[model samples]
Structures are given as C-alpha cells and as structure tokens.
Target: MPWCSTARLLHLRSGAAQLDRLEKGTTGLGTADALLALDCSAERHHVGTFQVPGDVNDLDFPLPGVRLESTNVIEGDGANGVACITRITTGPGVTDYVTHEQECTYSTFGIHVGQGDRLAFFGEGQNISVHLSDCRNDVGRPGAEITIGLAVSPYRVLTIPKGVAHTLDGLGGVVTRDEPVW
Candidate 1:
C-alpha cells in the first residue's frame, strides 16, 4: 500500500512513505530517524542524522509523468559511507531497462534529470558505487527519496506521480504537515 496526501507539507518519521505536493506557501517537509517520501512534493528534500533502518529499502513508485529534479545526502557523525540507487523502467510496448547504478555519500551528492523524465530507485545500499544515466521515456517502481521540484509552467497544478517511495533506515524523527519554512 501507499500513503497519499495533498496537504501543503508532510513529514514522515519512523520509516513512513508518502506522495503529494506542497502548497504554494509551504517550504516542504522534513524527516528524522531515517524517513523517506516517494514522489513527495515540497520545496526540497531534507535528510538528517540516524542509523539506516532495515525496513527502509525497496519501495514501489505509484505514479507516472513525473520527473525527478535532484537528490542530496548529508553525512552524519558516522564516518564516510555510501548509498546506491538502481533505476528500472517499463511501459506499454516498452522494454524494461536498468540505469547505470547511481551512488552518493553523506558528502552531499545528487542527480539531475531533464523535464518529463521517468525513473525510480530500485535499491539502496551502503558503500555502493557511483553510476549515472537517464530514463529517456520510461517509468518504473519507486525506490528512493529526497526533494523534487517539478518542471512545468506556472498556474499548473503541482502533482507528484505514484510508483515511487522514500525511506530512511534509522534516525527516527517527526513529520509536520503544512508547516511554515520561515
């Protein structure tokens, strides 16, 4: 199952998954103790310190026609570590393909896709290698987290597609809905 909300802001702690968009006046949401919001909308994707939870991996994406803007991972008190993202794609008359593994560390790394790109995180792991590729014109199950800024004209409804989910392994925290940024 998947969690869906249209509230301005949404926070998920204790390993929760979500999908929705932030209202015009919202600054987005936050997660502690390792939280992940798939296809979650807000100003950006923010992560905090905590151990990786065992149940925070492998989530399916629920929507299509959504593009991921970027992702960032900040380091905690722990020594240098690594995280990996495997992208799998499928569609009508479309063949399933794998994206070169995407990896990032607490060293502040991220990925950027153009407008209308469909992709998902297949898996996340520690000490993973770095690979980069694009999804061209396909979609797949959700597998990762962070913030996403949509690429469309103004006056358009901001919608987060399904088929994606976010998860933090550890470091549980609180999630707030419709919270002010300033």
Candidate 2:
C-alpha cells in the first residue's frame, strides 16, 4: 500500500476505514474532486496525480497521502480514503532479490525536485542487501510536507525518494541467490 493507489482505493471501498494525504495544494500541490488516477506519460521523470471523480465532490471525507494544490474538484467522491503514487527504483541487486518496505520507502514517481535535494536510496546496491537511508531533508516545510503510513506487502527495489524527511529502518542480511529472473 506504500505507492499503490489503485489497490488501496479498492480496499477502502470494500472495507470500513478512510485516509488522506493532503488538506490542500501548493502550486497544484494537493487533492482534487476527480477519479483516483495516476499517469506518467509526459517528460517529467516522477510526475503523478490523483483526480477526484465528477460525481462525488461534496463528499466530506479525509483522503491521506493527498496534497491539494489548486481547489478540490466540485464533484466525484465514489469512494473515500488516502492514495499514494510512488515511483521506486527496481534493478539487479548485489546477490539476491530484496523487497522495498513500505514503512520507509517513500515512492515519488514523476515528481520533480531540485538538485540541492538528495534521494533516499533503498534496497541493495552491492550484495549486502540493505535497507538504504540517506540524511537529506528534501521535504520543504509545513504545508509542503506529505507523509502517510500504510499497511502493505513487501517489495524489492533500489533508490527511493521521499518528499520530506524520513527515518530508515534497516534489515541487514546476506543474499545467496544471485539475481532473480522475474
């Protein structure tokens, strides 16, 4: 559930809880009243967005991981919950395959950032198989920060970029299985 928006929305509708990411937006920063959508087809590397549906705008419910930039769309609220669109790096590891934990991996896909900021690289670069962490506060401040906690299955990946400051929980281990073909 870390960066999988489509999956979570389905869970929300089926279950009986809700979550949200942002209360409003900055420079088109947050949520809107459109269908839950995540698209990456333009020139931007990590650009992603969630659109509120056209029928359920007036629905009053909090959706976590959503940062409203312009104004909430006037319609569309088929469901209620928080949604995150993440772009995690997936590549060969040093020895075996590893899963990217959702707790520490902040997947920001197609979102632009300045060079001054550093990316939080998770997964293993060499063979050690590590839960990567870098001390770089890229999350601007106050209203600019977007943080959300989710329950998700494990995944394997390399660099992970968080929009703000985050702490990494490391799980050091050895990889005996060279590289996975899948």
Candidate 3:
C-alpha cells in the first residue's frame, strides 16, 4: 500500500522560503505536507499539501516582508530526472541554475536560493522533490523600489547569481569563484 508523508513550508520576507516534501512517492501515490514560514530563523508552520504540477509562485502566502533562504528537498522518491531553477531579473536577462536533465535525481540542491518575484517548477515528471529555494529581499529596498522576476518555469529554471561566476565542480554542481566580469 502507498504511504503518505508530512509536509512543511516557511516563507521569509527577505525573499526566501523553505519547503518540505516530507514523503513523496515515485508516481505521486502518497500525500505531501506544505508549510509557510516567515524570516529565515523563524519557526515553520503547517500550510497544506501542494498540488503537484501546480503553480507555486501564485500561492498567496502570508507576511510578504520576509526573505526566502533555500529549497530543501529533505526526503522523497528516489528517481533520476531534471529540475530547473531560473532567476529572471525584473528588467532583462535570465540565469540558469540547474538545467541539466537527469541531474535532479533524489539528490538535493539549492539553486539560486535567493529573492525574486516568481519561482516556477519543472519536474522531469509530475513528482515533487523534497527541496527548498533560498531567497533574500535585499535587492531593491529602502528609498529605491525595485522588483525581480524569479520564474520557476512550470518546466524548470535555475539561476546563477549576478556578478558571480560558477564552474562545474566534480559532482556536476556549480562551484562559485570571484571574477572581475561575466
């Protein structure tokens, strides 16, 4: 018989949110627990089960003053597929966090865990990965008002931070290094 799992979510005013897919099945046979949290150091409260293949960026989460931190895929069905986390600037240009297919397996990743306006999800399949997207609302604040687009692509969009360059390390993950220009 298929089993269900608990879920939790935490949203930070700084543009960060934590999501827990506690226990998910390969074919989405089990249930999930979703929670919304405020502030990176605050407690996580139960929200509800997420609709797989649903638009997560449209969710009306409370407390819009907190910054997001990371997307933690704690535990779930172990499968090999691709997941993308993209960071779109409010004006122009875009960044690709993780676009490699078959890379977002049961493993964990935090692509551009930072602040933005939207976050889209494009799982190789309709299965939800146990992960979190970190974010921070430190970009345009105080006196100056600016907004950025964090589109999680109903398909997948991962972004590398601006001004910082990355190189693929040994584990197929990007390694950050200081560079004078992109």
Candidate with best lDDT = 3
Which candidate, 1 or 3, would have the higher lDDT against the true structure?
3
Residues 1-182, model 3: lDDT tens digits:
11111111221221222233313222221223111111122222322333323344333212233222233333334474433323334544443334434443333222222223223343323333222322222322211111222322343322333211112212222211111112
Candidate 1 local lDDT, residue 69: 28
Worst 10-residue stretch by lDDT in candidate 1? 173-182
**Model 2: per-residue Cα lDDT over 1-182, one tens digit each:** 01212222122221222223322233232333211222111111112222233222222112222221121213325374322224221433223334544343323222212111222222333222122112122222221222222112112222223221222233233221222211
Per-residue alpha-carbon lDDT of candidate 1 for residues 1-182, written as tens digits (9 for 90 to 100): 22222112322331222222222212244322012223333332223222222333322222343322232333345564333322222433232333332332222222212112233232222222221111112333222233332221111111233322222221112111111111
lDDT order, best first, reads: 3, 1, 2
Report the Cα lDDT for candidate 2: 0.24
Residue 43 miss distance in model 2 (angstroms): 29
The superposed Cα distance between candidate 3 and the true structure at residue 15, in angstroms, equals: 20
Model 3 Cα shift for residue 129 (angstroms): 3.7
Clashes of each: 26, 49, 51
Model 2: worst 10 consecutive residues (lDDT sum): 39-48
For all candidates in order, the CA lDDT equals: 0.25, 0.24, 0.27
Residue 107 error, candidate 1, Å: 4.3
